[model samples]
Target: MSALDHIRKLHLPDGARILDVGGGSSVLVDALLRENTSWSITVLDISQSALDHAQTRLGSLAKRVTWVAADITQWIANDPVDLWHDRALLHFLADASDRATYANTLRTALKPGGIALIASFSLNGPEKCSNLPVHRYDAQGMLATLGSGIILKDHWLMHHHTPSDKVQEFQFCLFQRV
Candidate 1:
């Protein structure tokens, strides 16, 4: 199972609201739905086409997911989520100001004591992905960037084999809002 799948299996409060940051076309929502349909799952992405594609792929199950098309740095969340998950999205925030905005937005969107599950390109990984520049990080970097309010719970590195058979290293960090 992927890091995301593993995180989803962890014991969380029943009926926790989950926000999949930059969820886009990822299948993580589908897995979450299968694991616990009772939990409210929302997918926030900047691309409408990505949301549309995910909705198409989900078919009847799509109705259960709340999809939002907006940039995370400035988007106002309609729900106070208990869990926030981001994969590679933080790396895309190349500008320091943008990263700060993202951090502020994260703090504003999630309720304290909530779970934050983030995956990012490791320091040794490619400097660019999907034709865009990326910022590499280790667990310490992520923790520092996220600020002291983040209480580290777990951290690890994983090698992901993409659809094109390329290997990309990623650092996964799990934190609880303190």
Candidate 2:
């Protein structure tokens, strides 16, 4: 299933806080807005231009979302969220220290028992993207990198068809903070 499909299956409670890490200009926010008006959603990305594009596309609905332009490794969560969704972001952290920081950030951003839906390049996927090398992972590798207090709920493999007509393998994992 697609990441959005998995999120929809979650059936999160009304008014739940959601953090879309590196969501940027993704249409996920648009879909989420249509799904539930009561949800408090935040889209965090390092690109201000991308966020602006999303805001323009969203128009009035943009006001409903909190847009944060900061690197996940350095960004601090003022409040914990019920759900954390990341797509094609984790694999970009090639440095071990960066990966550790990402894990810590995830822990700090998610409330106890909250859900995290992380999608990344699979072991068999491209070695690099956008001319930058990526750290690929399978479900087990992801779990190991995330460290303790997070338990895996489910995982699956998917093939993403890029705009350039290239197929990229990805692994999607669902976990719960303890």
TM-score winner: 2
| TM-scores, one per candidate | 0.94, 0.97
For residues 1-178, could you state the per-residue lDDT of candidate 2 as single tens digits? 5556788899999999999998996999998998899999999998999999999999999999999999999998888999999998899999999999999999988999999999999999999977899999999999999999999999999999999899999999999999
Angstrom error at residue 23, model 2: 0.3
Candidate 2 lDDT: 0.93
Report the C-alpha displacement of residue 16, candidate 1, in angstroms: 0.8
Summarize candidate 1's per-residue lDDT along 42-150 as a digit string, tens digits.
9999999999999999999999988999998878765678899999899998988888888777777778888889999999888998899999999989988888687
Ten residues in sequence with the least summed lDDT for candidate 1: 1-10
Candidate 1, TM-score vs. the true structure?
0.94
Q: In order, what lDDT does every prediction score?
A: 0.86, 0.93
CA lDDT, candidate 2, residue 62: 98
- C-alpha lDDT (0 to 100) for residue 46 of candidate 1: 94
